[model samples]
Target: MIRFEQVSKSYSGGVQALQKISFHIQPGEMAFLTGHSGAGKSTLLKLISIMERPSAGHVFINGHDLSKVNRKQIPFVRRDIGMIFQNHRLLRDNTIFDNVALPLVIEGYGLKAIRKRVETALDKVGLLDKARYYPNMLSGGEQQRVGIARAVVNTPPILLADEPTGNLDPKLSLEIMRLFEDFNSVGTSVLIATHDLGLIARMKYRTLTLTRGRMVQDGLEASGANGVES
Candidate 1:
């Protein structure tokens, strides 16, 4: 559902984040993006979400050309994409339910609909019992689960996670990955940018590897010896 054709991104001061990178992620696919620090994983995700425009080439989300989508259309495009980050980006002052409800609230859903959707999303992430709790009241892993719940509250067609399990313990990381797999099994396209090669190996999904801002590998079962620094 996501495609990048001959994409290149360059920043000020001669920084090249990506160079002629291209890939296609089909509907219902789950893939891992691997690379060292500054390999442009986040930059690529931003392009797909229309948060940052590519310096060159075209980015297609679902079927819409992102370059052609105007400012007024970004929110509509993002409605079909859910994003999760490494930091769990929760509001400390808000309860879990409120945090998860933010998207539907912004979409103008009524209280009843928001309540239903938030509860369902929290339940899916095994956080139904903690909906009333604040972020500080939960463990690191639980907080991450809350972030996942918030991202999927709208049941978006695509899920993009950046270093999602970066801070969790091995067990908790595995649990988090399983959650992604569950969502993917039900047909949500998933693309995760992670540094955990062991986890990637265990999951055995298609992986896209980047090095120095170029796509070096895009195939099934990335080898441990692929020479990816991350």
Candidate 2:
């Protein structure tokens, strides 16, 4: 579960990226984040992932307050989260299998276990046969799928995607959305940040909209409200 209580983030130059934002995402819930460019969507996700700290209030993840998470415990806390970026942040030199297996390898899992998880994840993304292929060898959509597989390879309970379908065509975007839904169907808490209004309308998921770093609307409070245009 994710909870933000009166959270605000300000940069060194005195630019505030988030303003007194508050929301709670329950376990096994799937939601969407929508806003215009520079609307604090990325900063909010970073706060949850601990890439950046808040200047005010608190951010709690799975019952742990991120404000009190020490540097030594950061990695352990991050292990419970899986992040997917808009850009396919794949290691071009590594094969798809190795890319997806990196997390397990970092955790010191044995070869057999890493292989099993990597293969299973690849299969889930419909790319098992492409395991030996490198990032440069795959299509854009395929590369994105590889990123998704890598993120979920370890089965982290919370999934955070920042503009996951930003670079894809409409058809491919729907396919990628469906993949996220598949994972959500299995109870992985999902929060996706996107600017695609049409896609948001089609999906009909609870949405949190930000405006100039302030939370302007939350679709959760209104039944059947997709979201207001940012």
Best by lDDT: 1
- Global fold similarity of model 2 (TM-score): 0.95
Question: Stretches of candidate 1 above 4 Å error?
Answer: 224-226
**Which sections of candidate 2 miss by over 4 Å?**
220-230
Each candidate's TM vs. the true structure? 0.97, 0.95
* Candidate 1 structure quality by residue, lDDT tens digits, 149-188: 9889999999999999999989999999999999999999
Model 1 clashing residue pairs (backbone)? none
Local distance difference test values of all predictions, in order = 0.92, 0.91
Give candidate 1's error at residue 69 in angstroms: 1.1
Point to the candidate with the largest TM-score. Answer: 1
Error of 1 at 159 (Å): 0.1
lDDT of 2 by residue, 1-112 (tens): 9999999999999999999999999999999988888989999999998999999999998888999999898898787899999888999899999999988988899999
